[model samples]
Target chain A: MSGNSNATASGAIERLWKPLVARSRSKRALLLMAPLVIFELLIFVAPFLILLRISVSEAGERGTAYAEGTWSADAYANVLTSEVPREVIVHSFTIGLIATAIAVAVGLLYAYAIWRADGFTKSLLLFSVVLPLLTTLVVKTYAFRPLLSPTGTLNSLLESVGLLSTPLEIVPGLAGAIVGQVYIVLPYAVLAIYSVLATMDWQLVEAARDLGASRPRSVLEVVVPQAMPGIIVATVISFAWSVGSYAAPFLLGDDVTFAMRVEGQILRDFQWPTATALSVVMIAAMLVVISALVAVLSRFGGEVEYA
Target chain B: MRRESLETALFRAGYLVVFAFMLLPLAVVVVTSFGASGQIAFPPAEFSLTWYESFFDQTDWLRAFDNSLLVGLGTAVVATILGVTAAFGQEIDDGLVGRLLAPLVLLPMLIPPVIFGVTLLVYFTEFDLQGSYVSLILAHTLWATPLVYFVMRSVFRRFDWQQLDAAHDLGAGPVRSFVHVVLPNVKHGIFVGALLAFIVSLQEFVMALFLSNHTTETIPVVAWNQLRNSLSPMVSVVSTFLILISLGAILLAAAATNLNWLSKQLS
Candidate 1:
């Protein structure tokens, strides 16, 4: 229980002896990180590089082809200029943007409601928001497939309730894909915004109210501004997730988005070069969006300094 | 006050509608799993456990479930060990290298799963490691490690190093101090991280889609293929079981680690 022993033992051990131990500590840290770094390089970095190499190579007559000549940008050119790839890229971004926007709006509303509600209602709302994150992606897609099928529950409900004269064609289309993506990504947005909401200083709202601000005005001015960082984070994360997504679009979209197009090249046509190029484009777009988001958030004093 | 009340009512209604929308498809799947009819139908004409029985009757589903459990447990164990150690290393130094490597550690989670899947697929094929459980577990660990790392890092950041100092001053070795002081404090974090890693590995599909094969097919892959190839309520039944398992895991983790607070930290 002696203070001097503890301080000398701990402080001197870490700080005063730092020069002597720095090299070894760093080496040990590097050694600890070696497994994770090596695994990431092997599984994540190497494949992308391989894809980049393959993208530049020329396709052969029948089997897997590699160019005997130097690397060229032909695959990229094809990905950029080709009608299908271009359309797919544009469509994918469009869907991603729209889906992200809708999710943010819906999630913000849901979070706001839950934050404002009292007792059991708040927990119930939060639980519902968190439920989708627990379900398997494929199972969710399959569940939607039946529900959105032509003669499915949605259509039957519509007809039985006299809401529609005909069964709706809900599956195998952009609408179905957007719905599925939104449902899946909504929880992320809610969680993000709710975190910000939970940490926010509620005293500001009380101050605004004391100063004659209406509830709506106070929320609009104080709550929204305060939660901007979370909103931005949620929006960017949702957009990136939606863009790179393969399952919802592949299963629900009747071959509409860039993801579906890239999936086709890889899974159906075995066009590895074009698919790899598309994947590169998608990753680049995500990095740009994320960087921009980080920059904007930093400017607003909302840096995500994770502990 | 009138306007506020109206706005609150409207928002409440919107929340209910959206909540119902989110739960609808999942609920339909669970209900259809109990259908008397053989096909996938919502609002089943009659309720029975036929599909559940058939689901159990199929060996393929059982095998896939076993594979999923094995892979999930393996990934969780590996990722947790690596994550805790790496995070501890970071905490020990709190220097530039740790800062630099932090984001890289998060690469798996930040990058799209498709990119991760394709990358791993290409990497595995090059090494002739495709279809091996090792490759699948490695791929999964890439995703799982980040979650465990983040959880453990936060736990370590808030850790009281004074106790370790006390133990050290009392003639305890590094290993002993860690075992007695560090482990006790971060045990909840480790448990939560492991739970999360397990749940993620269990439900992951895209990477598994590209990597898993006949011998290593996971529950998600099996359910995906089955749902695509056939029209039956059996998949629904299996899906319900998976959902229940995931829910149980999440709740258990929450109970173990004050998950309501943990969820906020996770985001």
Candidate 2:
């Protein structure tokens, strides 16, 4: 195994070195790539470096963002010990968990429906999924307010059906947040699962069903395994976006999520160190959780043939 | 046979419910935009275009719309150029460097926008570029380029590189060959990528909110400020306008490339 790894390593090195020495083609390629590399480094990488710096910097006075060049762990400590931030973290994770679960479950079903659909039905189904994706994130998310508010259409519909005498407040609540979050992520999840399902052979499920397995049993056995990669992708996308979401929670719900808290710290409070520190902590937590999620989901899927 | 029919019926019903869930908010917004009432009411007391007129009448809303358009167009142009070239770069250099570059471009897509927002807010402040059009466009380009890069990557894969080689052999320069040979073939991809980038820039809220001042606030940023204060039918009207623009762009993209091509790109 060591010898095999050595060969692979040497091969990788050869591939890397030979391109630089042997051909002018790589030179041309470098020229083409230069603009993007510099742009990303300047705008993407440099800013993150600034964020990291600011996170450790001492708190600035009123009207100042942060005390630059003076490093301290006070901001991290405060966030770790704080009550409001703790609740915000928990709230963010709760929304992420609930939204991911619902989005993935519904996405799976929606994908299956699209797969089974024929001709115009199939196109229409696909179009519906894509439509929301193309629509502005804030606009679609903001729509939930008018739809789910106390005097919104949903409550009116519920009342007319005699489901409730008066509207149960959903908007400006957790339920609204989850619903809005799910709506935002659901399209990508559907597409993720559908892309995998599109490549799957329906005959396998049919064969399983013909051999005495029930419909659900056949699907669970055949379709679920095949769709596992997509499900995992869907889950990760939903979870990450949900946890970091600003629009859904901000618009439809009044909850204090991590993103909202971070916003408050920077914009409203002008506590740059606290905001950056909180963001750094949240980002670290997200990376760890998402990595763990991928690891667990990969095992559950048996083996993911990543395309 | 009876069981199979029952299963199909159940599946159809289940699908309808899910579809309703997916489309309801958007449908409500569209319906609500036409409401003539001063207050946001459902099943509008009457249908009128007063809100749409109100949106058009307001200078603040109009300025926000203009800023959104300017930023969206600028981001689309910059991102498309970077993404297309990067796609070319990756395709040409399929070595370790290519592998490294591929993930680097896509990294922005994975990182949360809030982090990007806050970080850039600080970075731009230090540089004294805060509230400038340049900062807003550059901030948007960071997000949009990755999307354009992904789309163009897929586009490049289906493309034939032999034409480029032929153009080179015939003494056509890289620029000339790219412009004459490579571009015409992948025009559809370029159009689609640019549109997607435009849409991304147009809809993006968090980054704009963090970076923009009152003068530079995009439609979503303006809408967000308004949303916090009150529920105006004018906001709904603005949203409807955004929806229409996005829909038109999507349709244009679909026309440029088939629906299947679009769906495959989504994955």
Superposition-based RMSD of candidate 2 using all C-alpha atoms, in angstroms: 6.1
lDDT of 2 by residue, A26-58 (tens): 777877777998898899889899899999999
Candidate 2 stretches greater than 4 Å from native: A1-25, A302-307
User: Is model 2 an incorrect, acceptable, medium or high docking prediction?
Assistant: medium
Error of 2 at A58 (Å): 0.9
RMSD of candidate 1 to the true fold? Answer: 7.5
Shift in Å, residue A293, candidate 1: 5.4
Q: Model 1 misses residue A159 by how many Å?
A: 2.3
Least accurate 10 contiguous residues by lDDT in model 1 chain B: B258-267
Off by over 4 Å in 1: A1-27, A65-70, A117-119, A292-307
Worst 10 residues of 1 chain A by lDDT: A298-307
* DockQ of candidate 2, scored on C-alphas against the true complex (2 decimals): 0.59
Estimate, for each residue in A51-70, the C-alpha lDDT of model 1 and write its tens digit: 78877877544555444344
TM-score to true structure, per model: 0.91, 0.93
